[model samples]
Target: MSFLYFDNNATSRMDDEVLQAMLPYLQETYGNASSVQHKLGRAANTAIERARIDLADRLGSTPKEIYFTSGATESISTVLKGIAQAYNRKGKHIITCKTEHKAVLATCESLGKQGYEITYLDVDAQGNIDLEDLRKAIRADSILVSLMSANNETGVLHPIEKIANICQEKDVLFFCDATQHVGKLPIDLQEVAIDILCLSAHKFHGPKGIGALFIRRKSKPIQIPSLVTGGNQEHGLRGGTYAVPQIVGMGEAVKRFEFHSQIETIRDYFESELQQHIEEATVHARGTLRIPNTSNVLIKHVRSTELMTKVPEMALSSGSACVSGSRDPSHVLKAMGMDDEDVFCSSRFSFSKYTTNDDIDLAIQQIKRAVTQIREASPIWQMYKEGLI
Candidate 1:
């Protein structure tokens, strides 16, 4: 059976170009980036620096502002923890939303145990943070406000720009988890007024195990207090031997994204075609502004896992890859005010530039057939047919 992979949001398949760019680093150019005397070290450093420039360029930031780590989770932890420590002299309060990824939420939770207070802001029915609520939440004791740019499960784009502006007015530090949104959508740091931003490369067709954190120059200089205090690497924020090949691959992935302005166009087309083919499907276009590569749909009367099982050839997920095993309804859907039925029946489909129209058609057919098969066996659908639903 042929397979269709629609789970880009979980982790995208490595792009061929990225793999090609990383070949030398993995094969011949293997050297520690911290070495200063060896030619191999210089070569590795060159590749890493070039990749940094590519990522910085994509975000409209200088390379100096970009700090590499072992993917978005570490980057987020480093930033959140670093900011909290650096500014602890000022206050002990932090703010975030209920829909944040486990990385951000768990970090905040750990901080809460350490005497820091956290305020998880509520979202509207559309999965948007209320600016008025945010304004009320801001206090002199608030040290940081961490919000996600786009929700990992629902692809809902939060009003980060507005939130950042608000944080600025309140003189509070702002951090954004753009792990799901960075490469899939366009981001302008200067325009967004974000103080700190985090991104993972694998979510955008790059290799896993590599990510970057962007710290605004205006923010008080960050000192992570050393998560790994040895060798004094990653500007002393994170200390470990750098993964050269993965970083090189991430840079190449960013360069590839630069040429693909029409990627979102492809995703929009897929959404339209899917809507046309599946009458019972309800697409959750999170908010007015969503990343073009993602669409979460609720197909009533069919459980998301059941639909996936029915269509074994398609690679899809019920929600964020990180929380796939939880059995609990998606916190993102709940934050959006979705009922139990809607949340349980929802599945996420994310596209990449490599996804063609043919893939979309095949996915639509698979989903329709799968829904039909599941609904045929569903008691709710049976009851509806008997006028008992």
Candidate 2:
């Protein structure tokens, strides 16, 4: 049997166009972008700047405002830490939600240890933070508010425009990690007024290890401190040689791609079929506004690990890829008030532009079979059937 891939939120397969654009940089145009002496080096530098302009335009930013980083993880760390270090005198308080990616959560935790007061706002059962709570959390000492544009595991989108507005009203810097929703959704930073935004290209069919950050200037320029200091790369904010091939690929992917409505239809069909086949299946964030390709489902009495084992051909994830090795329940779900069992039984299925209708049909069948088998052998299911509660 042929396999089907549904873990696009974890990482997407690179598009052929992006790959073709990167080939020249790898095979022949291998020159240091910082070395402007030779023709080849100048060529590399010019290529990087062009890529910068491509990404900047998509974000409604100028080339000078866009700073390339390793990926979202690095970008998040840089933004959070940079704000913390640069504006400690203004205030060391930072506000963020509980369902954010580990990149933001972990960085905030680290900053907390360094004497910064970090306020973690609570979310509703639907995995969305309350704007009122956000308003209450912002104190006079608060200098920054970091939030994700979308939840990676559940594909639950946050209201960024409103969030940015609140940040502006409070005179706090707004930072958004746009890793999962950048290419999958229509984003115009010029209209949104986000102070700092970060996204990884790999999440959107670009090369891995290449991402960019958009920094907005409030009257004067925003001075973000450096984490990786060695050379003058990334405008002295981040140092090290540029990954020219990855940068080129990222530029092509971002500039050329648009969100596919067909994928959303397929994802909704898959969710409906799962609910029809397995009555116990509960879809997380189904009613909320979300990215088109993502669907996270929880089937009672069926552990995600067992489901994966029962249907080895289905490529899905138990939780975020970043927490694959850990045995803990999803922090994102836990923050939403879900019990441990709900988190463990939930599986995330994210489609891509390449995913077909046939793929969704096959995946639904595999998931139905897996859930049936898992529940049949589960003592909890049997106990519930006998009214042991």
Candidate 3:
């Protein structure tokens, strides 16, 4: 049986247009972007610059402000560590939320070991951080605020505009990890004053292993020393030869990006059908705003792993793919006040621009069957049915 893909929050399918655009760079124009001496090198350099301009234009930034990296993880590490090093004189404290991606949380954890103070703000049951808590969290020693625009597991959206405004008023630099939101939703940097932002192309129908970082340079010219230093590439910020094909693919992806509302419709339909058919099914963060492509749901008395095992033909996950191997409950859901059992019962069914209603219908069918099978075999499910604790 063919497997259905519903794990778009982990990574999106690359666009065919992006692939076509990248072919020349990968096959023939392969050269060191730093070495613009030969034709191939110049071609590579020009392609990279063009890609930079395209990405910057999409994000409402200038070409000078954009820097490429291996992916969002590297971008997150570079900014967190570089800022911690460069701005330690100003302050050693950084503020973020508990529901952030592991990229931010792990980097903050590492910073904590280095004597830097890190404040992890709390999220509500709906996976939203209180604005007042954010306001109070900013202190004299607070130099940076790192938050994500969307939760990887629940697809819960942060009020980024308001958060950015608060950071601006408090005179603290704000960094937004927009990896899941960038290509799927609309984000205007000029309207939202985020000082530093990072996005991975793989999250948005571009090639894997390539991403971009946008550091605001117009208003105050935020500065941080290079974390990956070797030679003068990315204006001495990031070093090493650029992946020309990946860069080209990212550019094409950005240029061809369009937010499909149909995915949201299909997602809502999937949730509604599941809830109507499956016993005690619930959608987490359903009351809150989310990216159009994701739906995190739970069917009571059904363990997510067991259900997934029964339905091997469908692509689903309990939480972030980065930590999928861990047996621990999802930290994102746990931070949202879900217990270990509830976390294990929940599954994420993210959609994509390519996802269709028929695909959702088939996934729902498989999920219903698998969930029923898992629940039938579960003693806890039997106990629940018998009204026993």
Candidate 4:
């Protein structure tokens, strides 16, 4: 049976071009990028540097500023803990939002045990952080302000430009986990002063286990310790041999994914189709500034888990697949002040450039079928039909 994938936020399907580009490195020219002497090594090293240039050009940054890591988790850990260790004397206080990925939140929690103070900024009803609340939270000893460029579950966007300005004025380092925004959105580091940014290739169309960290350098220099030791790779900031195949694949994926104007139309059509079929569905953060390719909804009287199970051919999810096994509702929805039912009924549907109109239509049909089945069988839904809910 054919399956439809709407879970791009969790991971993307690798493009054929990206796979073809990486095949040679996985077999033929397989040499350590750190080896500078042999021809194969030089070829691999050159390919890695070319990938760096491509990533930097796309992000409007310099090649020297990008550091390759295992993925976004490693990139985030390197930045947050590295900054905490290196700049703890400057300040132990770091401010982040409540809706951030587990990568940021867990890392901050780890640092808290080491005597760092983390302030989690709450989001408004639309999942946007209050600029005034952030400004008020800033202190003379605030060392870093970490936030995500786009929310993983709701696709809500943060005001990073303003936040960047605040951090700059306060002389505090800014870190952004831009896993969902890097390829889908137009990001120009030249325009926004993000001190540190992390993104994963798998979030785009590239292979997994490879990502980049963009660190903006200052004249006085920002000191961050190495997350791993020895071999002195990634400018001695990260250790271990580079995964040449995945890095080359990420570069190839970047070349294929240019932001087009029509992406929002596809998302809008899907939302329109969904609202038409599921009349009582509540689209979360629909009016807020969101990434063009994501749509999150909560169909009343329908349990998302049951809906997903009822349509196994539909590759959709309730929320972030990173925490997929958790039975609890989304923390992101809770932060937006959604009631327990809204949280329980939430479902996330994200798309890629490769996602077609036909795919969206099929997904909509599957969702409608699933919702009808789940709601028809529910005792609560029956009570609501009699005006009891």
For each candidate, the alpha-carbon lDDT, in order, equals: 0.85, 0.90, 0.90, 0.89
Error of 4 at 162 (Å): 1.1
Full-model lDDT, candidate 1: 0.85
> Residue 44 in model 4: shift from native, Å?
0.7
Decide which is better by lDDT, 1 or 2: 2
Candidate 3: TM-score?
Answer: 0.98
Which lDDT value does model 2 have at 104? 88
Number of clashes found in candidate 1? 0
TM-score-wise, the better of 1 and 3 is: 3
Q: Which ten-residue region of model 3 has the weakest summed lDDT?
A: 218-227
Q: Using TM-score as the measure, name the better of candidate 1 and candidate 4.
A: 4
TM-score of each: 0.95, 0.98, 0.98, 0.98
- For residues 1-389, write the lDDT of model 1, one tens digit per residue: 56888898999999898999999988899988888589999899988999999999999998988989888898788877877887788899999999899899999999999989999999877777889999999999998999999988778888888999999899888899999888777898868889889999999889998999888786456455655567777677778888999999999989887436566777777777777876567778544677777888888778898988888888889998888998999888888888888899888988777788888888878878877778777788888768896
lDDT for predicted candidate 3 compared with the true structure? 0.90
Give lDDT tens digits, candidate 2, residues 241-352: 9999999999999888787899899998888888888868899988789888899899987889988999988889998999888999999889989999889989999999
- Range of the 10 consecutive residues with the lowest summed lDDT in candidate 2: 215-224
Q: Candidate 3 regions off by >4 Å?
A: none
